[model samples]
Target: MNKLWIVLTYAVFTVLLIIPLVKMTTAAFSGGLGALGDALSRPEALHAFMMTALVVVTVTLLNTLLGMMTAVYLVRGNWMSRWLRRLMNSLVDLPYAVSPVIGGLMIVLLLGPGSAAGAFFDHIGFKIVYAFPGMVIATLFVTFPLMVREVMPVLQEIGTQQEEAASTLGAYSWTTFWKVTWPSIRWAVIYGVVLTIARALGEFGAVLVVSGNIINRTQTATTLIYQDVENFNVTSANGAALVLAAFSIGLMLLMEWAKKRRGVH
Candidate 1:
């Protein structure tokens, strides 16, 4: 029975993951390495990748800082009322519950050009909707939960005893965080950052809706792939997908390495 289960698992994995990866690889290379290079070297493709890198870096940094703060507050803020903490905790998971498309639409509704906030920002010469800022915001919405979720459990598990001890020993709050709290949650923060990067890289719906997929301005790698497919440029789409897949695979390996390091520690 165990042998049968093992075979079944492999079969399922191959069918769902391996086969598709193989197919994509084949398709991406169908026109040879020169074609793949050409596809990726196009002006639009270069811009799309650069936009994606910007979003990923910005979102990851913001999410890591804010998410860790939020998790610490939720877990350790004695000043917060019980109900308030509960409310905040529930809100952290809102992105996971809500569809990304809906999240994008909400951004559009709240801050698009027609809305008051959007108009205000636009009048101030800072466009939010259908621009780079909007893309970052949308990606942030989709990826925020990842870091919070990763850090919260670690904070809970490590408890506040050490932090309290540090404070009692005359350490300032910032000192306590750096000396007593940071080391404990560092791995969790790293994990959250990796997850945020991965999600931001592949995010399509929200970014598309918010960025308007403007070429050379707000286009991301995923949206570029969508545009390519829509234009029946299958080769270009395949090449772009392969690049994303390569990044994802590298992240996966890094994640595994981190997991092993955490385990050893």
Candidate 2:
């Protein structure tokens, strides 16, 4: 009966969360699945969809490479490196504690119109603020710590034995990484990549400040959602929102699959 009560309590909590999500999904698909499909195919909507997709893909790839390298180095290096790792670990807390708008402001202060980097970019005729590059960089900063945290623990857990074993077999570092190291932590890499992608896709406060939201040109799905909702185009906004929610669901499924695969192995 104790087990039964525990299960009942968990079930109640699950239902409380799941009920609203199910309603939203149903509402998104109302007028039938065909309507949802049609909504997703609209031209501006497609642009937003593709832009967000590119952002997720680009950010995930960048974060994975950077995170994997940083995690491995932190695990393998010396005393100075230990200090650097501690610094990075402490820096990760900033994203969680700082307001997104504050992050945007920080970037703007350093890269905005009159700042030194901004002036250099102006001299080169390459605008950073209110542009794609700025948006991508800002999103990268906000979402990066998630990837680092996810991958670092897995790297720490796996340790150097597998790497040492490969090295002793006359394998060079790159060869050993591809041949042995990668296989051991592939799931961790994928999980961290997915988390990075999800966070990048949903980023609003930081992205908005940099993107300039110039409608049909620079507006990402997220910023587009905000613009639509602000303009009272709730239907279109909800449509954009549903696409984002679908991406979120896809991430959840991917994480579940990764967990199952790890269990099976």
The TM-score, computed over Cα atoms with residue i paired to residue i, of candidate 1 is 0.98
For candidate 1, lDDT tens digit of each residue in 1-265?
9999999999999999999898989999999999999999999999999999999999999999999999989988889999999999999899999999999999999999899999999999999999988998999999988999999999999898898899899999999999899999999899999999999999999999999998999899999999999999988999999999999999999999999988998
Q: Model 2: per-residue lDDT, tens digit, 37-155?
A: 66667777787777777777778788788878777766666555667878877887688788887787778889988799999997899988887777777888888777667777877
Q: Which stretches of candidate 2 lie over 4 Å from their true place?
A: 1-16, 19-43, 79-81
RMSD of 1: 1.0
Compare the candidates by TM-score and give the number of the best one. 1
- Per-candidate alpha-carbon RMSD to the true structure: 1.0, 3.0
Computed on alpha carbons, the lDDT of every model, listed in order, comes to: 0.94, 0.79
**Which 10 consecutive residues of model 1 have the lowest summed lDDT?**
158-167
Highest lDDT against the true fold, candidate: 1
